[model samples]
Target chain A: MTDRPKTIDEIDTPAVLIDLDRAEKNIARAQAAADAAGVKLRPHIKTHKLPFFAKKQVETGAAGITCQKIGEAEVMADAGLTDIFLPYNILGRQKLERLKALHGRVTLSVTADSATTIEGLAGTFRDAAHPLKVLIECDTGGGRCGVQSKEEALALARQIDAAPGLFFGGLMTFPAPGKAAQAEAWLAATRDLLAANGLACETITSGGTPDMWRKPEGQVVTEYRPGTYIYMDRYQIAKGAATLDDCAATVLATVVSRPTATRAILDAGSKALTSDTLGLPDYAELVGEAGARVIGLSEEHGKVELPAASRLKVGDRVRVLPDHICPVINLYDQVYLISGDRVVDILPVAARGKLT
Target chain B: MTDRPKTIDEIDTPAVLIDLDRAEKNIARAQAAADAAGVKLRPHIKTHKLPFFAKKQVETGAAGITCQKIGEAEVMADAGLTDIFLPYNILGRQKLERLKALHGRVTLSVTADSATTIEGLAGTFRDAAHPLKVLIECDTGGGRCGVQSKEEALALARQIDAAPGLFFGGLMTFPAPGKAAQAEAWLAATRDLLAANGLACETITSGGTPDMWRKPEGQVVTEYRPGTYIYMDRYQIAKGAATLDDCAATVLATVVSRPTATRAILDAGSKALTSDTLGLPDYAELVGEAGARVIGLSEEHGKVELPAASRLKVGDRVRVLPDHICPVINLYDQVYLISGDRVVDILPVAARGKLT
Candidate 1:
């Protein structure tokens, strides 16, 4: 508390502040883990949309950047990042056209699990100068968007290989936590199936921050994509990804109302900290407080219920480590990067509303 | 499905579409209800941040507009809104200075529930050319952010009246659903206390869409501020404020993947349809699908688990009515105003992300 920064007092209420030192350390630690595992680290830029951090990940030995949409890849490409991986099933005519335009700029790759998605990508890029790389997204206990069985994956891979302009990249899956073994089994079984069918398996990318450090070793999965590890949150802490200190981003909010002795209101609410509690009781981890729970959120008011003896008053600023950092970052247009409370830099959330 | 507009196919996936006809009906119904109840309808523009809608409200018998933040008010003023009420306690050196500047441009009043907040406002406007109106935020039964009792409210009102550059505006409260009686009693008791102290209660503002139709029928409350009534949400519909057909805004998303016979994935997720479920099980009301629930949200994917017999497939576009509309609108940069299925106009969410 003694080493106060002048900028801390000037920061407005309901602002986002990132600790650069902690973020850099998190990035380096994830990179080292991927290096030791001998897996290519394709850091997901969906968490931190700033090009400054995207370039930082590449400079720290990341193979490329991973984004969920072509819009995000376009932002990264505009910032001069060459390699981009979109690990989602992109459809619709406008999106495919935009994806084609993005392919003209960078080393682009996408993931798909269905014939409709494969046909869409092939139709858009069939006559392009370069054959587009498409990965088969496999269902590995996540039960989300991926092919169900090894036979289904092999069928998709053969179709992709036979396509005029699409290259069967490999297998990709976002495994549920504690299912890395299942992901490895699924990918290895599919890779074997592809090899038996004389189809080339180029890269196997499996990812999730919960089991990020425990990616199955050997040649089963070649690359790992982890987004939330860059700025861990309460959800990550609960998932045992990192300690609370490993969390780099926090919301700076002021207690605007002390309605009662046990209840205070913060300027930040669902609009700032996001209401995705990740199954936690509190919307966020109230920094430097004991037994303070953000109980509810209206559009603009965060209701924090405290203990009877709590002395939190109006105009007092407190930092909140959001329960889920990705959506919270999506709420703000820009975030202030701080080094020990001294504002270091402010970066625009480039891919913030690029939801399409 | 036969009446589908030609423009429906052109809208990108995960786009917000405002049914202009439905929105107009909702706005007219709320305004007529306020007029019937003999209260001023000062519509809160936090839900639809577009200037076009705010102007529409004012033109349709609204006394003024209510916004939560000074940033939102600044945008409204830029759009030629002359009178604005910010019913949240603003804090910090930067915000108070901004509030003082806003007071110079328009008829501005704010709500306060603490002495510290009052002092901050008093200090900022101590010698200004105009006296700032300060309303005592009273806690009826919501218990979120307001003075706990009539005594505490009167104390704050007296403090505001005694301050050099502050005027006691009246009382304000965001009462809990079906607590209009409680709000009426609280405001009545506070008004009696203020009258005994020879103070004027100019405008008593009570707000909440849950009991908008039953705003306490008395001269005790002069103004009603219901933000969500303009574009009712699923929560409001459940509270009997409006029907499902009364909902104006909906997210249009394409089913990009059907991983299993019972599992479907939409392009909208937490980033498109917010994770603030408003205590609902699903993040949003899945339109046109019986027994379909938005079971899970991962940044770019909304997993909708339906019945085994359901025939949902990829490339099928569906509409999602969010559980809450205000924060959902805040997430987008602009909205497409549609008449039937054709886009009539495109409005910028001008005050989107002005969460200072």
Candidate 2:
């Protein structure tokens, strides 16, 4: 795929362009933050979904890679990633069979909170060569997935221990930023409960890119997974996770139409930059331009309400830092890796659109 | 993809289910509306990028197909479609070279709004064996892309007429809903201006799914392209473009977690139903559940705030009708075609992520 060109200027529009220098710096910065916190770094592959970046993270001292879906884990395994932690409560027989196959291919561990999911896992991996490891997902403050309280966490851990062909690895939670202490306390209490039940948990995982730098000082967790730290987005910048200089990926688009004096349309829209505002009013912020902003999108056209002082015109190429790059990266098959106007590589989003 | 299940109940979670009955009705109903208006129907493939549906539209008496991008047109041509209209201002050398190659394969016509685009088309096809038909996109009331006024359309038409390898085929516009008269008046005025300049235009195309049933009478538009009418969504329901029963696609997701009695988390998130609100507050609306709403998405989990009387529980399979189905369709590689409780067929979204 890198055979397209050697220079960035020759490439087409509506492309996911990553600045390698900024990506490398972002990776190192995240690694250093993890080192300071004394936690094993297992970067989430949901951000890039490319094995090239996953391999780079492993080479940079990452313990393993994190995946959100079975299809993504399958792709990473095909790419020779030996270890993977899937932080998703995979269910149903159709998916469990795929999960079992992936587990056989790699050192796979998955998270679950419900008995139905655990039962499905136990049924699928019954009498396997190696028992599948299961982690209980604890609900700290995100309110999305996980056990609600320490009691629920302990009950689920006991269920995993009793289930056939299953190993109770540990507990994990995706806590909201600023609630690290609360989450750590809950995990610690849950660990105490598990010990009271005559069971010991080996690993405790904590995640969330926003809380990556400030892991609970007590080190209640053994490892951390932060997916969006590789290509920091506007959401990360707004949340004080990373600054604008730390963002690595930008969608390169061309202004195809200028309907009015103060209005222009770009070829990239919700399909390119994504519709995940991450609670922002707009899709993305204009890179290298002040006062100009992307107002809206209609499927394929991004409507830009240009500032009166802006000099953007039709046929002009612009870089837009998306509010969220994970979904945006999943929208394209290939991304151009650039370094100082030179296209260094074009990596395939190998696990893109792995919805099921 | 359907090999995993024998019935709809046994199918996987987070899967796209298309009701074949509703889809067939949508196709026939749209064609009947076009027949009543006495215009050629060229449905846009941007909504359902599957060549199967494109072939269905043509089988139901569609004049041709309209694609938003050249990559879509290429995919349609590969499926043995003879005619395609790309209603986009395609620019850059790489795309133009691909367009030239595609033009040789099918009867391809594209729309242009600027001199830069016209120059690119003319230069690419100057020494070709056949001339390419070009349409001048006029800005009627939809101020996204096109010539702003009648004068600009005439000037671009004149340039198309003067170009060696380009033929000024006609005029086209994607206007605001309920503004067909305004668009017609502007296009009629432009056609008169072109006639006065000794240029004859063959086709006058108007588009928009919202205004499909109400194309301005008296044959102002020779052809119409409506994409969303094939699979109506919540946005269309709110816009009076479709009824609740008109929607054909529904995302089947399992309740993965229940954080509280009043809250439920679905396996389908932004990646399943899409993060696109289309100006709505939530991402998707529950199909049969009256009070349930998809409040937020965190990439893999759709946070649903349940009403007090909601009967949703963990492992319950729910159908979510997205606010917009186009981007949601692009999120999955295969969609299950179902009729009642039977799994009829499986179709791949052939042109799902052709971003180039």
Candidate 3:
């Protein structure tokens, strides 16, 4: 096999490329912020699933890792990292079986918002040697999942404590910016409600890159789990979660065809950067170049509309910051690591495309 | 290590499942259609990207395979496949070198839409021991890529013939239904122009799933390259390209959470099925169910607005035919191959995430 290569042109087009210097800087900055805020940092590993990067976070005083599924948790456990949390509701017989088994290999935890979900998890682990610990997920106001109100959350937490073979660990929410303050208010109310019911709510976790910076001010948040801060995508930049210079990952692509004077095509399209349209608002600043909107995306072509002032020529290489970085990373097998002017290593996205 | 799982419920959620029985039927139907139309069938491998599927197509009488990138073509060639065509403009020094190397391993051909691209390929393959084949790609009005007029296409074809290590193959286009006649006109004019220039215009390949059934009368298309036929998707069903029963690939997702009476969430989202919203007339659609619209999608959660009369419940496994199949396949590491009610094998998406 070939060794690591240098320069953007040296890497193949449509491959994921990460700036190690930028990545390390972003990690250090986030860790410092969490330390100053006096909250435990549990960085989400859904952005960059490489075990090498995960190890870096663990070495940097992170409380634990947040994964999206049991499959991802299994991959991380195989890499010898413990203290894993699946922030999604564990459902179905197969998933429950997998979750029950995961408890034996590591310090595994999960989230739930309904009685049916809690009952399902309890039933799966009822006869097991270990009880399954879980967090009661609150909507706080993302409106995607979780219980809607403090009263609802408190009821769920008490029910979890009452269930056999299950332990109520804490509360978790994927709070949006608009609801961060509301979630903070609800978290306080839920804590008081739990205290009145003689229940202990020690851990209150709030997540989402958009509202990550506000966790310190929330007062009720004991831990923060932000995914996009590690890579800093276009959407996160638009949401003011991170700066353009803080973006660690970029799509290194080549100009394959300039079909017209105004329209040029890149080898990377939805299959490379994805058809993620969430981060188009901050396109001008992220690329360090002017006047191009990703107007359309075919499977293998990204049709970028060039402005009259833009002077890009055919066969020139370009860098694109996708709207969403996680799915973009899932689209490539390997990512080239760059430091200054030299290539350091080529990291395999070990968990790339492990959707199941 | 695990053998083929028996039931969809036995496997994890958000898995890509292929009905092999349906897939074989779909392939045979497409082959019969091409045979009846008296055109050579060279199926495009962009949809599956698996060597196993490509080999199946060849076994079922496909003339060759069509790819969009040299990387994908190289994967196919490594599997002992012989003939291949990359239907995209080959530009830049790095890509040209890879393309020249690929030509050494297989019967390789590429598409060219401009003089610059043709010249680049010519310069790279000039000293090749074997001749390099070229196809002048014409825009039949998809407005994506290709030359706008027959005169421009012929001029480029003549220029390719004049250059070293170049042989004019014929013409290619990705035209829609109403534009097939326009492409046929361009193909006729370009064929005459190439003949007038004393060049043999052997094979005119024009195709897309939408226009596959509407081959124009007396058109110059001697061959067709229709992808998306092996795994017909929701987009194909909507565009009259293929019916829902003809769809071979479906996302096996479990209803992980029922947040509301009106809204239910599935484990599969853009990460599993992808945001490839192509060929579908609208944003999203429900595969086997009616009036189910995918309202929003996060990384791992697909929020669906349930129809008033729908009966979907929590933990129910639903099969969703993705709006587009190519990007969906790129989002998974393996696909469960099922025949009738039994899973035959778990085929690795061998070239999965090979965006480069």
Candidate 4:
């Protein structure tokens, strides 16, 4: 503890820094939005992957956290987050055994799109004291995963209801950006179909940071999961969900080389900032450095295309707002939490690299 | 130790698997090529970032290991690697202090492309007993980090030679693919310029995996550093450097869902395989699936485009050859070293996230 840095300037380059004030405000704002919409806000821990932030979200009136994997949920559970929703198809024997162990410790719910995945889950939780809550993941035009049609969703829900140690909870979806209305319409129709089949659909979960602020006017979605609003990125700004000032997380880097008049290199590269352009023009936007863009990245060097009259010199520090912040946060083992140039804390991203 | 996985089938999904036999063959082949070309092979450890594999490379006749950051070099030095070359412009006071400490522990050398970077290195190593070796990094058409012209190289070499506790080692370049000959010619001219200026150029290093097997007929380069030869990837295959059988690293993922007739979802995603397309067609190539390709990736799901009538089921495991192997390797904490169907060893990626 004695060796800890006292200020942001004392920290090393290529480090992820979270503005504590901005992050807290972001958390409170998202919670308020969900409250006003009368929907439970389930903040995805994938954005920060830190228990500190997850607990803050929960304390700020979030219903529960949303995790994409059992490993992430396990981390949150160990940190005393009792409720979690894993919106993924849990498959295979090894993962199912772990899921069962995790289910015993937390009030866990999961989503499945196929009967094979449901069978695996049902076999694992068949003799548990409490039934595992399983949701039918519907492909509401996202086309990534989930059952294709309303008939398919009904079939999976029926399978879950008939399983030995499983209960059909509801329906879940990860809709594409700008397709929330279509996804809500599909989910509503499917809920009706399930009702006609005598299966009670208790919950409807829909999520995406791009559409986080859009209210569910159809009144179909009961829960919303938004991960990146805690630390909005260039992609979120491009989608009009946030502004540059709302971005709380940035990669602090030093100009290691000024190779040419219009080219400068930073210590942070794909390993630090990540290479997820999310269809953006550049890898990242250099904060306060107008016309300078991270054009390319090697494993450890960020090549910046500078303006002709750029004053960026070697040894000068700069902050970069990555195009996508979720994957960037996953790249680091720990991040610095700062407040107005003071280093407040250093939190380890405990759930990072939990690929299982 | 009793809980160790005995075979590949028992290991969890979304795991990085290193084929021991293929990796060893790749190592031996690269070393033999360097030997045939009469140049020292300094393998960059950024590809694997594991001391076990770095030691294996050293045992296979590599002159030294090249690290992109001082943190990575520190990890390798702790593991008893003596000679490490870091080919990045080392900047900032904090990093310089770490570089000074690392220099005291091992035969450490670094690269510089500007006077500011050189000044910091000289200020840190001024009173040391031994002079630090500093190489001038030339752009050589890479357009990344490095001096743009041969004259800039000479100026930096002169500065290094004149500075206290510093020695001008030579020239280094990470050339663009298919531009090796042009880079070599530029280095040859730079070496001639240094010689005419009474500065002795001891070593000239140039490296890239795309042109690993190509010989330097100009006889100017004395060393070569290739990072990706150990785990050849789809990018290497696209460059005609290696075949699919030569690939040593693959992400073993389980097919979690077949959402549509032409789409299947795997457990591995950008968090495991990374989003580095490297100008390739897809995220990864499924090892044995003829027409299956990884089309898109979320954080925890790989949306694989499957061929019609595909047999990939919900529980079947598949191996994926990523487009770029270096960044993908950095995403995992440990990799299973496998020989045929047996899990031989589980090695921690000790330097995977050493961003600074």
Q: Model 1 segments beyond 4 Å from truth?
A: A1-6, A215-218, B1-6
Candidate 1: interface RMSD equals 3.8
Tens digit of lDDT per residue, candidate 3, span B97-156?
Answer: 888888998999888888878889889988999989999888777767788777787789
Error of 1 at B273 (Å): 0.5
| Model no. 3, DockQ | 0.59
For residues B108-221, what per-residue lDDT tens digits would candidate 4 score against the true structure?
888999998899888999998899999999999999989988899988998999999999999999998999999999999999999999998888999999898997776889
Indicate the fraction of true inter-chain contacts that candidate 3 also forms: 0.57
Mind giving the per-residue lDDT tens digits that candidate 1 earns over B55-98? 99888889999998889999999999999999989777778888
DockQ of each: 0.62, 0.62, 0.59, 0.78
How many clashes show up in model 1?
0
Instruction: Report the CAPRI category for model 2.
Output: medium
TM-score of each: 0.97, 0.95, 0.94, 0.99
Q: Which consecutive 10 residues in model 4 chain B have the weakest lDDT in total?
A: B1-10
Quote the positional error of residue A38 for candidate 2 in Å. Answer: 1.0
**Candidate 4, Cα interface RMSD:** 1.6
- Give the candidates in order of DockQ, highest first: 4, 2, 1, 3
Instruction: Give me the TM-scores for chain A across all models, comma-separated.
Output: 0.97, 0.96, 0.94, 0.98
- Positional deviation of B61 in candidate 2, in angstroms? 0.9
Local accuracy of candidate 2 as per-residue lDDT tens digits, A123-152: 888888899999999988877888888888
